[model samples]
Target: MDRHAPSTRCAVITPQLSKRAARAGSDRRSPEARLEEAVGLAAAIDLDVVFKGLVLLSEVKPATYLGSGKVEEIAGIVQAEEVGLVFVDAALSPVQQRNLEKAWSAKVVDRTALILEIFGSRARTKEGTLQVELAHLNYQRSRLVRSWTHLERQRGGFGFLGGPGETQIEADRRQIGERILRIERDLEQVKRTRALHRTSRKRVPYPVAALVGYTNAGKSTLFNRLTRAEVMAQDLLFATLDPTLRAVDLPHGTRVILSDTVGFISELPTQLVAAFRATLEEVIEADVILHVRDISHPDTEAQAADVRDVLTELGVDPEAGGRVVEVWNKIDLLPEDERDRMVNTAARADATDRPTLVSALTGEGADGLLDRIESLITAGRVMLTVTLPAEDGEGLGWLYRIGEVMEREIGEDGLMRASLRILPERVDLVKRRFGAAQVRTEV
Candidate 1:
């Protein structure tokens, strides 16, 4: 975190594991683009990126992941630049990580560990902290073998009367096991609490719309633009760790709960995926999911595919009908001609599945985006006009609770008249709960 310190200097090495194999639907992004993303991730935590490069390998080494020659070359850079940390942009086995550290004589971290560090530092809420800690503990548990060699040493003893050294590794394992157990227990409680909250939300009439996309995709900025709440909409990756919710009223006066969740990334850490499952349940239960994209980014399509892959892993079909909305943001950063051309090109695409182009920073095309959301949410609703006695406050209140009241007026004869747009499923309920004769049909 100390940006001024020389010890914070780090080097990034992205290994090209395959020249023929490509990430699903991400062939457009070159390996260099992927390496730039890795460097950005390292910089997210204020790491001073002193050296970075690509290591092309036909095959991965079992022990060090990189060839011996490549390892030696990186080691020279590490020593010359005094890089205290080396970040490899790929998953590393425990043995590989240990061997790399020994060869380079520096602390080594893989992409997963680097992400966990950023999540750990950015988590603010108690639930967010607990989730991040659980993931960190799980990852640390797997690395204990490399970090502690004493665990492998055996103590000579007989039966229960073993030597004191026999207890060392056992105690360490037991301690870690116990901590994992405690964290799991705490997380289970958190999960149950979230479930109960979701259950309670079901009783509310508001439809839930969740915003999900790749890291730094301008989701938070769009969320702030729509909800008028000043959330931490920074340009940094993983800026929003905990899910935030705010009630947003659509153009038709229909209110929906809008949730902003943690952004997705390529090859998300498994520990994080398991630990953050409860947090991601919001996306699973959402009535609508908004897949926001940074249109200005060079790898936007690949990033979208990565986000969809994560969504699929979370049990939501990205291609499901009426389930996901694509929000292409950051058009304000483009030149006037380029922005117009991009918008026109998007318009020429299949309009049915095309994305909504908007600049969250400049508040352009936001109203049309809201109109699309409103139409989607209120697709099956029918507008109605109902009349209630002026003294019948209960009927009026019920109407406001379950439907969008577009207009209201009190007649001189003491009868209150109101116009509303309500869901089809609530029509029978309204007639039965209130007086059937009091309600009238319109539209």
Candidate 2:
């Protein structure tokens, strides 16, 4: 979690495992691709590689997570290579991790632990940090068998040591549980505050557009293109951890709040999802959703399903259905013929109005994307006219905040004449504030 500290060298275990099973029947990713993803994730954290090995476990040896022979071989390699750490690409039981670490005289980390460490390191905001810490504590709760001797104990507690301290593991779990409860309470307060803010935004009635996609699928890139603000968009898992909102104008000058949300991933840890529910409220409350897909990835289809699965789990009503715009991003990475074929197929899909192909990095097809967004949010059209006094600058500002002003002119009487295309809700606000006498036209 220390960004400034020197990078640690460790050997990757999953990189060495190869699946002999053909890819004809399984529902999982190919072994090679999964290993590549794990390694790429590890490299992002700046972990140096000393060695990589793969171990296969027999059904009977599942408790150890590796066969005895493989374990002995790993132990030999650790000693011979002077490895400082060993990273397993799969989840391991607490007993297994402890035994492996003791046998090799090196630190041992499983896939879940590695991911938690990454989340802990990447979290920036207070809420984000608290959520990550809560998830980490929940994960560590079940792995409390391993203990450290040096920890201060509570007064009057019974213990064999008879001194003033207890085992570090027990003290750590107790502290973690208390901290987790406090974080939950704080997050509940944050959620309530966010709900109030959402309600205030609703009064203006600007449509909300939420970005949902698999990790590293360029959702952030497209979000920046639409909102014209710089947000972190990197080719790494969960690069954009916090949800960001910005006002964006479509081609017709209609304004809507665009939200860039946390990217989804296959098999996302349950603890993480529960902890970050407050962050994902953007998706649930959105008037329109943009399901961005990386058409260039080999696992694109599965990735799309994964995003939808998470959305469903978040109670976004996959069947009740709000407007969904499919944005196929990273088209520039595909060959021209393949891209054309995808575009044609997308045009024909009955699930959506039409798919928009875009390269978020190079700004290709961004205008078309904006047009589609406008169509989805506006349901084709809106027209309105209102009158505001010259002194009503606050009302004029609200007009600009809500939608595009098509025309503005000062009358001889010193009143401002304004025509705008706004969402229906905004038009209602204008009518209520200025009175029916100010109305000119509505469509």
Candidate 3:
């Protein structure tokens, strides 16, 4: 039978681990919560979740990952419920996945594959498409074509999740290898283009602040609230896959580039992390990173820990203080007493570790969020007093464009005295244009 098309009817199973799964003990949420997320993942791709369950594993079985009796139980459910697809909410080995398919007589997808499916459907940009395709190819390469011996029909080159350009994927191993190479090469150029864009933005003196958090934690909502751009913000997992950037003026005079990026989830696939590193360069280079959280969720703490893990894997230290600001979002869903408690907790903490509670949907506490972001960006700046000849318009223009001009006046002696708050990195340029003695920090 050909399983090239996407399956509409699906069953989601969350396997609670008693042992290691890459970073064991990393996922500490209740199994019920995990099952809900798995169902949501299926929903993200428009799959109807007809069945969902929790499988307690004392030790993961090598053949099926589930016990033989449990496997038999699900097999009966598959036939009764007419499930065309089974989404196992854990990483399954090639052999394990094949065995499960044989037992259930349904297309079986592991957690990684389900997440990839969601990403494949959500990708809206060329760069996002490249990253998703690269990740899909990388993942599919490991599931050798030899595993599909029972299928009499010819298979497509695409991974488990079938989307656009499905016919273009060749079944030959060599062709898949070639496609991977081509995608990687294209991604390199995309990375270079992104770097050039960052360089250009640096010239304008606008600091980049990226939004990151657990999937569906209201990041895109907050981003839209701040930037006034209508990027996709829905109550779905991985709703916005493409990274979007918009400029917003803070409560203060400074402006910043607010980037809305793909949200993080617990046990994010390694293939995706390696493939999408190019797109996450913005978060790595951002001057301030807003770690948004759905404070009203029952599993909020677990979700926060998951986001921090992904950040650490990306070489960002979430606890390094000032750079990563925790934005407690979706407080509009919380009770009044709980909201007040969170506000008090945030108020008691120091600046570096404090969180800014806000309801992105209601426009509550937006000004405070902007102020916090501006303060962190401004903290790295130095106040400089520069004196240049009034006749030299070019030099005067550079200072105004490169820094925030707080005060300016023309001296009686054909000289312009201006005090500005300039980023620390740009201080040398000011000293180079004008004499070192003419530049002083009055404030």
lDDT on C-alpha atoms for all candidate structures:
0.86, 0.77, 0.88
Count of steric clashes across candidates, in order: 0, 0, 0
lDDT of 2 by residue, 1-443 (tens): 47698777777886233345222333456556666666766775778777765454324244556777777788888888777878888767777787788777889898777777777777888888888988898887877653321232333356665434445566777988898899899889888988998997876657789999988889998898888899988888878887889998778766789999888876566778788889999898998888899989888877877777888888875444337777899999999899889978987877455668899999999998888777777774467788889889998888776766777899999999888877665666777888978967664
Model 2 clash pairs are: none
Candidate 1 residue lDDT tens string, 1-443: 55566548899999986656444454557889989999989888989899999998877789999999999999999999999999999899988998899999999999999999999888988889988988887887777552344544454567674564556756766787898899889878888888888776665567889999999999899999999998899888898999999999888687889999998988889999998888888999998899999999988888988888899898899987577889889998888898889888878867557789999999998999888888877777888878888888888888887888888999898888889888888888888876678778785
The TM-score, computed over Cα atoms with residue i paired to residue i, of candidate 2 is 0.84
What global local distance difference test value does model 2 have? 0.77
User: Sort by TM-score, best first: what order?
Assistant: 1, 3, 2
> Which 10 residues in a row give candidate 2 its minimum summed lDDT?
146-155
Best by TM-score: 1
Q: Model 3, poorest ten-residue lDDT window?
A: 162-171
Model 3 misplaced regions, further than 4 Å: 1-7, 19-23, 150-171, 385-392, 406-419, 435-440
Ranking 1 against 2 by lDDT, winner: 1
The deviation in Å at residue 415 for candidate 1 is: 1.3
Best-to-worst ranking by lDDT: 3, 1, 2
In the range 108-152, model 3's lDDT, one tens digit per residue, is: 999889889889888888999999999998898887544445432
